[model samples]
Target: MAGSTFVIAGQNAIRRFKPKDHIFETLATHVDQEMLNKPNDLAFDALGNLVFTCPGNSRQEPTGYICALQPDGRVTKIPEHMYFPNGLAFAPFEDALIIAETYRHRLWKGHWNASALKWEDAHPWVEVGGPIGPDGMAFDQAGNLYVAIFDQAQIKQINPQGEIREVYPLSGRRPTNCAFDLSGKHGLIVTEAERGEILSLSVDQPGFPLFRGNNGWK
Candidate 1:
C-alpha cells in the first residue's frame, strides 16, 4: 500500500489502485450496511486498524457511527451514535482519533486502547459555529486543524485549543473534503464535490506528516 492509493466507493466498498499501471482492485466489499450505510471518511490508528465514519441519513435520526476494520477482516463499531459522522483523523502524536459530526456541528475525540483494541474517553473536542457543517479535516505541523465547511464554501483553521483562529473563503461550492500536501510546495488541496473540481491553495504552514507503517494502507 505504500505506493498505492485507497479509495472508498459509494456502494459500500473500498478499493486499492496502483497509479503507475492504472490497475484497480477491490480491497473490501459488502461492508455491513446496518453499521456502515455510508462510509464517508477513513483513517488509521496507531495499530494500523482501519477507522471509518458512516453518516447515516441525517433526516431520519442520529444513526451514524464510527467503525474500525481490523487487519484480520473483523469490523468493530465504536460505541457512539453521532448525528452525522463526516470526517476522521488521528492526532499527530497518535494520542486520539478526531471525528467531525456534521449535523451536530462539533468535533469529537476518542482515545485508543491498544491492548483492548477499542476506543475510550469519547468527548466533544470543539463546537463549530455557523450554519455550515464541518465535512473534512486535516492537521498542520503546528497542530492546527483545518475543517472544510460544506454549506458555506469556507474552510476554518482551528488551533489545538479547539478555537477557530481563521477562515478562508473558497470559490468552489459544496466543498466535501480537504487534505494538505506534505511534499512539493506544501499546499492545501480541497475537493469541490458539487462542481466536480479540485482546488489547491498555498498555506503558511506545512501539513503534519502522517505515520505510515510497512503495510502501506495507512
Candidate 2:
C-alpha cells in the first residue's frame, strides 16, 4: 500500500501515481522546476520516502545528489558528489545509505540521519569492477552487495566487510538488474540491451544462463 511520486532533480514538483490503475493521482503534474533534468535510479529510505539519482546529463554533474520525496510532497536534494551515481541501498547495520557510482566504478556511503542530506562525510565505501560500469544493485541476506556490471557482462559480489568475493558473468553482453529468489539459491537478472530476455543464474554456479525470455511485458 505504498503511495507513488515521480521526482527529478531541481524540480520541487511531485507527481504521484497508482500502480494498480496505471494512472496519475491529483498531484501527478506538479514538479520542481529548478532541479537537474535527468535522473537515474529510484530507491527508498527506511521511512519509506522515495529516493533517486539525479545524474543530470553529464559525467561532470558536480558531486551527484540523491533526491528524497518528503511526506509533504516536496523533493529535497542531497548533494553527494559520487561519480554518476546509480543504484542505492540503506545499510541497516551502518545506518547509512550505500550508492553505486557507475562512472567511478565504486560505492559511496552517507549517513541516514535527517541532517545527512548535505554532502559532508561522503566518501568511497567499496570499489568494484577493475574497469566496468556498475549499474543495478541488491543486497543479499548476508549483506553481500551484488552489482550488475555493464561492458564486462558480469555481476560482482562485494562482501559486507568490503571484499570482492565473487564474480558472476553472463553469456549475455549486458546485465541490468537482478533479484534473488526467496530461497536464495537462484537469481533473476534483467539485461537492458540485447533486445530480448532475462538471464537466470544459479547462485551455486556462475557464468551460465538457465533460461531466457522474449522481452515481453507478460
Candidate 3:
C-alpha cells in the first residue's frame, strides 16, 4: 500500500483504489496515446516513482518494457525491451533497479538516470535458472535480495555480493510474488499460485523501506 491508496496493475492500465471508495481510479492507460501492453508486476523507485513491468507476450525477441507513473501523472517507459519482464524492485540504498528477465532466466541491475528518466548499465547481472525463471522479488533491511524461483518451489536468497546464502523451500510449486512486512509481526510473506495459499516466514530483520507512492510522495 502506497500513499494511503492501493495501486495495482490492471488490464492495459494502472489502477488505484482507496478504502471506502467504491470506484477504482485509472491512473494510466497509454504512453503518448499509444496503448500499453498489459502491465505485470509493480515497483517503486527511491524517488517514489511508481514503476511497473509490461511484458506484452511470449516472443522470440525481448519486447517487454518497464514504465513509470511520473509525478505529472503521465505514463513513460523507464527502460524498454526485455524477455517477459516479470517482478522488479528498487534497491534500498540507491536509485538502482533490479529486474527479472523471466524468460531469459537472467537478473539485471541498472542505475536510474534522472535526466533521461531511464536506466544506465541495464544489463544482465546474473543467471538464475532456466525457462521458468525468477518471479516477484523483494529486498530485506539487510539489503539481501530474495527472488521467487518459479517451478523450483523455492525462494533464493542472494546477498549483495551475488552469493547464494539460502534456498528457502516452499510447500507450493509456483510462487508468483513475495514481500517483506513493514510491521514488526510478519517478516516475509509469499504468494503461492499453485495451491492458492499465502505463506510467511520469520526473518532477522524487517524489509527495506520504500517510497510511499508516485504522486506527491516527497
- Candidate whose TM-score is highest: 3
**Ten-residue region with minimum lDDT total, candidate 1:** 27-36
Best by lDDT: 3
lDDT of 3: 0.80
TM-scores of all candidate predictions against the true structure: 0.87, 0.75, 0.91
Q: Write the per-residue lDDT of candidate 2 for residues 83-180, one digit (tens) a residue.
A: 67777776534556678788877888767765444434777888776365777776665667777887777888877787889988777656766755
lDDT string for model 1 (1-218, tens) is 56777677767766668887789876555455452576778877777677788776853588787777776666777755678888888877657778888887788887877546677898888887647578888888888888888878888898877789998889875778889888847499999877888888787788875546744243
- Output the better candidate (1/2) by TM-score: 1
lDDT score, residue 216, model 1? Answer: 29
RMSD of 3: 2.1
RMSD of each: 2.5, 7.5, 2.1
Per-residue C-alpha lDDT of model 3 across residues 1-218, encoded as one tens digit per residue? 34345365556888777555566777888976877787888876655577888888855678888888876677788777788888998877676788999988879998876546788888788688865999999998788999998888888888887777888999999998999888858788999999999999776768986554443642
